[model samples]
Target chain A: MDNKVHLITEQDIHAYIDGELSGERKAAVEVFLAERDLPLERAARYLRNNFDLKAVRDEVYRDEKLKSEIDRLLARRKPRRHLIGASA
Target chain B: MTNQANTISTEDLNACLPALYRFAYTLTRNDDRASDLVQDCVERCLRKQHLFDGQNLRSWMFTVCRRVFLNQIRRDKVRGVAVDMEDAPQSKLSISAFQEEKMHYQDVVESFRELPHNDKVVLSLVAIEGLKYEEAAELLEVPVGTVRSRLSRARSRLRDLLENSGEEGTVVAASV
Candidate 1:
């Protein structure tokens, strides 16, 4: 391991929090966060924000009225079928 | 309609409705406009069902929603109708009525709404919708690098917003 300090980029920190970093880079991020409080707090905030946003989306997704409305709208667009001998 | 065109089942389309709506809401930031966008997209999906390749219905619907939104933006621009981002409340209830946790969540949502449109979409895709960078790129018809960069910038901006909102120290202290 290189004893020199590595400056953690915002991208790297985010990728680390997002689990996009791998192998050596992941380990490096872990080390960097272990020694820092601010970035770690920022990472925690990011995670918290992600969770909160997903909660809001979940509430939106479960709106029964919206679901029924979408269903009704799609139902109205179904192809019209005609009888074989029906006049124009 | 062609006899040999692929078609997606209504059930599958319905299943993807919530996600589609969420994406639309993130883009338009208005309930009525988001509903219109979703309805239009669904109408097109039904009308163009035969054209679907049937690989990823969710992604296809998302692509449709995004295209519809972009087209609407163009038309609105030509007609001089600006889509106001701050016209609607972020949530239905008053923030004061909620407990501390819920208030925090609402604050986050408010801050999220303040982000740029592109940032909101990118963050919604990767952060809220849990889409991989590659998957989001494909849905947005952009390169993977673009998604990554947008997500980074969005995250940084969100952090700044949250911090400036005066909740950063509280959030950190609470977590600690």
Candidate 2:
């Protein structure tokens, strides 16, 4: 399993996972992945779990207490009133 | 009926506040600190309303918030405030179920947090904020090539770290 990673260059793996490289490079990685015993599923799982930052964003959004504080702050900043009577 | 032209309104801010909070949370990785950061940024933006062109409200707010956070970091440096990555409290979830999964997630976050601050900023901007590479490059004020290199380094390092180590040990310190 140690040498299974030798099938793809690190940069090409990155490009493959990121959907960056295309045409020949893309096909090259796909062909490489097909023959390796590196557990492509596990590699993909690692990438997916590690990169899913939207989950973090959702956690931050879930905090209702924080939402209230932001709401309060926004309320206090309700813009200054216009001066209607002074036209020099 | 509300006129959008007269002044900044609560509705506009209300819509903006969530994104601001999310960005601040990603930047600071601490809920309370991120909230404070967002509050400060919004207040500053409101005070300088003339600077806003209404051309791209979201990007403008992001620029303002990012500036405010960076300014705070700079000021904290003058006061000698040390931001220790190792000090972030571990999640309190019981490790009884899916212990490996929980550990892996923690390891990833720690590894990410360990990256240089600039790297973290770009990673979060693209990965978390869902910005295009071009948009992230613009946000970081760097060339697209620089963005690609940093992101490539960051993701590869993360993969290597995850693939080569104990499941429970903290790599955040080493990665940073």
Task: List TM-score per model, in order.
Answer: 0.48, 0.39
Assess the local accuracy of residue B122 in candidate 1 as a C-alpha lDDT between 0 and 100: 74
- Scored against the true structure, residue A88 in model 1 reaches a CA lDDT of 20
Looking at model 2, residue B134 earns an lDDT score of: 54
- What tens-digit string does per-residue lDDT give for candidate 1 at A1-88? 3566666687787776565666667666765654454565465456556656665765433445433543443344323255223322
Instruction: Grade the docking of candidate 1.
Output: incorrect
Each prediction's DockQ against the real complex: 0.09, 0.06
Interface RMSD of each: 13.8, 14.6
Worst 10 residues of 1 chain B by lDDT: B91-100
Clashes of 1: 0
TM-score of 2: 0.39
Model 1, B1-176: lDDT tens digits are 33433887788888878766666655554455667889999999999887776555665666566568658766654543432223214432122222334556566777777787678777776776665565567667789888778988998898788778875345323322
Which 10 residues in a row give candidate 2 chain B its minimum summed lDDT? B85-94
